[model samples]
Target: MKRILVIAIPLLLLTGCMHLNDPRPKHYKAPVTTVANKVCVIVQPEADEQIVTIRINEIGNDNNTLEKYGLAVIASAERCVTDFGYAFTAGKAYNFMVILESPEKKKRGVQPSARIYGASFSLWRLNGKLQATPLY
Candidate 1:
């Protein structure tokens, strides 16, 4: 009886350890570009119900290429605000895609162009369905 118990304990411990190292979930793909002429900026107010603001300096145009672009800062109470901004729609699903454009190659000035390196998207439950989209 003692021998059997010892072997079973070790086997159970090994099985538990194996389950702890489960594989991670697959990576999510971000949008490359978005349609021009339409730029969406979503804002989620803080707990205090403070007013959120976004400032877009200039949406650049490169060689007639249509790219989703914007420049702005986010302010929120929960400190969960993103660089571009947050998407907040009461009872409606929202998606945000932010593409950081690289600075112009040939331009010498005091301030360099703001280059967007990557983009991100968020999904959440709003109203009665799941709506997810990229914001740029």
Candidate 2:
């Protein structure tokens, strides 16, 4: 029993250290190197519109190229917030989309508070972080 215990413990410990040198996402077809890092998008708030609940998500585009770069979605959150931001890998440039939704009470005559806004940004990371300018 003692001999078996000693051998099994070291074998398990060695398994954890085997992949310490290689750092790459597990699902990629090839190794990815270029990435934008931390990217942020500034969401504009409308004074006329009252916001009670706000949810922002990095939606899949026509190509659905979020993970194709490096941006991964955290559950339904998508790593995007009311601030609206995300970063992706380089190599092949692809479109990224965010759906920011603010639901309000339904008005009898007016349309629901739901609205979809779209914009393209040309921004890069500086010192591992980038803040997006307001889309106005």
Candidate 3:
């Protein structure tokens, strides 16, 4: 009985460790492409400004050629915000597509993992308008 108990305990410990190493599911989609040219917009606040870092992941399965589609800096905004002004070029329309990625929880030491939760993207316009084509 004593020998059997020892072997069972080790087996249980090994099984527990094996389950801990299981890979997490990849739940993210790539960003969509836009016909309009992309321009980086940096909005500075007047006073007590807050800066944000926005990431625009490429939209496609080609991992080797991932490019940043749209990037902008907004002040005091909770989520990512983009606006297109006259600088986008008069008469020529533009579109903006984004893939918002949710922050993932990473494992740290023996404690449970921590995750910030992120989102991914779609398409919009550089002029703050949603259109199918840049020419429109």
User: Which stretches in model 2 have alpha-carbon errors above 4 Å?
Assistant: 1-36, 45-87, 91-94, 107-109, 122-136
Local error of candidate 1 at residue 105 (angstroms): 2.8
lDDT: the better of candidates 1 and 3: 3
Put down candidate 2 lDDT per residue, 1-136, tens digits, no spaces.
Answer: 9999999999999998987744331221111122345443323433233223322323334443332222222213222322333334322233333332233323433343333333343344446654343222
TM-scores for all candidates? 0.21, 0.31, 0.24
- The per-model lDDT (C-alpha) reads 0.34, 0.35, 0.35
lDDT of 1 by residue, 1-136 (tens): 9999999999988988874534332222333221221233333332222222222221131232222334334333234224243223322323333332222311333122222222333344545544445444
Question: Positional deviation of 23 in candidate 1, in angstroms?
Answer: 42
| C-alpha lDDT of residue 57 in model 2 | 28
Please report the TM-score between candidate 2 and the true structure: 0.31
Candidate 3 lands at a TM-score of 0.24
Instruction: Evaluate residue 28 in candidate 2 and report its C-alpha lDDT on the 0 to 100 scale.
Output: 10
Model 3 residue 118 CA deviation in Å: 2.5
